[model samples]
Each structure stands twice: as C-alpha cells, then as structure tokens.
Target chain A: NAGVTQTPKFRVLKTGQSMTLLCAQDMNHEYMYWYRQDPGMGLRLIHYSVGEGTTAKGEVPDGYNVSRLKKQNFLLGLESAAPSQTSVYFCASSYWRGGPESTDTQYFGPGTRLTVL
Target chain B: AQSVAQPEDQVNVAEGNPLTVKCTYSVSGNPYLFWYVQYPNRGLQFLLKYITGDNLVKGSYGFEAEFNKSQTSFHLKKPSALVSDSALYFCAVRDDILTGGGNKLTFGTGTQLKVEL
Candidate 1:
C-alpha cells in the first residue's frame, strides 16, 4: 500500500495564481492533515479532516482551504499565492480513536515544494 | 491549547558517541507525545510515540525516548550515533481538547541533528 502519496512534487506560481496540492492515502486512515514547513517554523497544521466530507481548521489555516471529498484524498488549495505561502507542503494520514490515550503515529507523504514568485 | 518545544536548533555528536535531543510538551492532561525524523527533501517519518505504559519507548533506527511526567519532557536518545542519523527531528503532542475527538497534533520547530565521523 502506498501509505500516502502527494502529487506535484514541485511547483512555481506567480503572485495571485492558484493551485492545489493533492494528497492520497491507501492506509484506510480516518484522519488526514495538511502542514507547511518553513525554516525555524517547524510544521504548522493548515487543515485536517477526520473523515470524508468532514474538515476542520488547524493552527495556520487562514491562507488555505481544504476538502475531503473522498476517504482517501485530501486537497489543499491556495486561492492566491503569495511569497509568504512559499514553503514545503506535507500531507499526513493516521488512524484516530476517541480518547487521549490513542496515540496513532502519522504517516507522511514525500512533500511538495511550492515557490511563489 | 497544546504545544511542543525542541530546545536546540541543532545538535552535533561524533559517530560513535551517544546523543540526546531534548523535547518538552504542554497539554491539559495525559499528553500524547511523538517524535519524527526527516531527511533532506523528504517528509517526516514517525520515530516513536509515548502514550502510556513504560515511560521508555523504543522506536525505529534504535532511537528511544523517555517520557517524564514530572518535567513534561520526552527526550530522544540513541546509544551510538550514526552519520546516516543526521537529519531534522521533530516533536509533537496531541491536542488535549476533547470536543472534536479529532486528535489534532501540534509540532515543535524541529532540531537538526548532525552526526560526524
């Protein structure tokens, strides 16, 4: 199983352009997340879905949008690319149980490098 | 709100020497902690997690972390460092909020570990 895979490994967008980074998982996970990694900024969650047709805002979700139309895919979209949005995007999937004690390890995709000019 | 901190931005160690990367977390109760590694241009890989049971959790690549409840720390350690182990390491904790039952994770800024010969 390709635990998780992301499309468009690298992309360059002009300011005000739009794009979407696609993430897919075959692990049958119930949780999927989108994160951006910047130098010294670590990984900040942008959006997440607990299940198909369910989505939620995360720590840094202001500049992005997401959808989980299918159980295996999560899409992160940038309506208008900006220099500040230029960063490495990562997609992760994991199983989720109802309690705090259920520590499910998240599996990540290779990541997409986005450059906004 | 939940948070994680990787105190060091970078850590250096000899190839045959022991190594340690510190992490501290803050959560309401029963924090679910995790460690992940990232090679250059790659996605984060799950290393270890501490939920319950033994405080010492061993994980991939001979890495281990001790969960100290008193100090709210989960420091990663390895008996002998390998040059291949040079990578970026991250610490994360699950959100303590129980409203959504979505087990969201908050990550540290990351620490770069350099193992030299």
Candidate 2:
C-alpha cells in the first residue's frame, strides 16, 4: 500500500498568496489530520476530519481550512498565506478504534515544505 | 488536555554504543504513547507505540521504549546505535478523551539523535 501521500512536495509563495494541499491515503482510514512542523516546535495539529464530510478545528487552525470531501482524500487550504504559515506540512491518516483498550496509530506522508516570502 | 516534553535538544553517541532519547507526557487518564522518526527532508515514520502491553515494547529497526507509568515517561533506547539511526525523534501522547471522532495526539519538540562513526 502507498499508505499516505501528499502533493506539491515544495512550494514558495509571496505573502497573501493562496494554495491548497492535497492528501490521499490508501489505508481506508476513518480519521485524517494536518500538522505543521517548525524548528524547535515539533509538530502542531492544524485540522482534522473524523470521516468524509466532517471537519474540526485543531490546536493551530488559524489561517488554515480543511475539507474531507472523500474518505481517501483531505484538502487543506490557505486563504491568504502569511510568513508565519511557512512550515513543513504533513498529512496523516489513521483508523478509529473505540474504548480505552483500543489503539489508534497514525501514518504520515512525506510532507510538503512551504515557504512564504 | 495532553502534552509531551522532550527535554533534550540533541543526543550524540558513537556507533555501536547505546543511545537514549527521553520523553515525558501529561494526560488526565491512561496514556497511549508513540515514538516516530524523521529523516532529513522526510516525514515522520512510526517506530513504536505503547497501548496496553508490557512496559517494554520493541519496535522497527531494533528500537525499544520503556513505559514508566509512575514517571509518566516513555524513553526510546537502542542497544547498539548505527550512523543510519541519526535522525529527529518525536514522542507523542493520546489520552482517553475522544475528539473529532478520534483521539488527538500531542507531540513534543523533537530530539535530534546523532550517531557518529
């Protein structure tokens, strides 16, 4: 399985520019998430979807929007990019398991490096 | 709310020597911990997870983590380190709370491991 894959491995944009990042997973996962990685900051959650057609805000959702139109795909949109938004973006997918004993492990994509000037 | 801490910014070890990366987490309930590795210019890769099992869990590439409930710590260890093992390591935690249809994980600032020859 290809697991999870992200589009536009690298991108450079001027301030206020817009773009969309596409994430696809072949694992048939019920949950999808977007995260951004910065130096000394690890990875922070941006947004996530429980299933198709569902979305929710995460820890760092400002300046970013997400949509899960299809189960295998999730899209993150930047309405107007800012210099603070320049970071390595990652998409991950995982299957949902209920109850305390259950475990949910996420699989991550190769990441999209974005630079805002 | 959940959070993870990797106190060390980096760790250095000579090839064939033992190496350790420390991690501690905070959560309200039972914690699900995980370890991931990121090579340069690559996305994070799942190395191991601790759900409900023995305290010592072995994972890919001969890495293992010890889960200490009392200390709220899950430290990754490798008996004999190789230069190829040099990378950034992340420790994450998922608590009992369910949000957006699944559990959300909090990651620590990564620890860079340098295995020298």
* Superposed Cα RMSD, model 1: 1.0
lDDT of 2 by residue, A18-67 (tens): 99999999999999999999999999999999899999998899999999
Off-target runs (Cα >4 Å) in candidate 1 are: none
- List, for all models, the DockQ compared with the true complex: 0.81, 0.81
Query: Which portions of model 2 show Cα errors greater than 4 Å?
Result: B98-101
DockQ for candidate 1, please give it. Answer: 0.81
Estimate how well candidate 2 is docked, as a DockQ score: 0.81
- Residue-level error in angstroms, candidate 2, position B1: 1.8
True-vs-predicted CA distance for residue A81, candidate 2, Å:
0.8
Docking class of 1: high
TM-score (chain B only), all candidates:
0.96, 0.95
- CA shift of A92, model 1, Å: 0.6
**lDDT tens digits by residue: candidate 2, B22-84:** 999997778899999999999899999998769999999999999999999999999999999
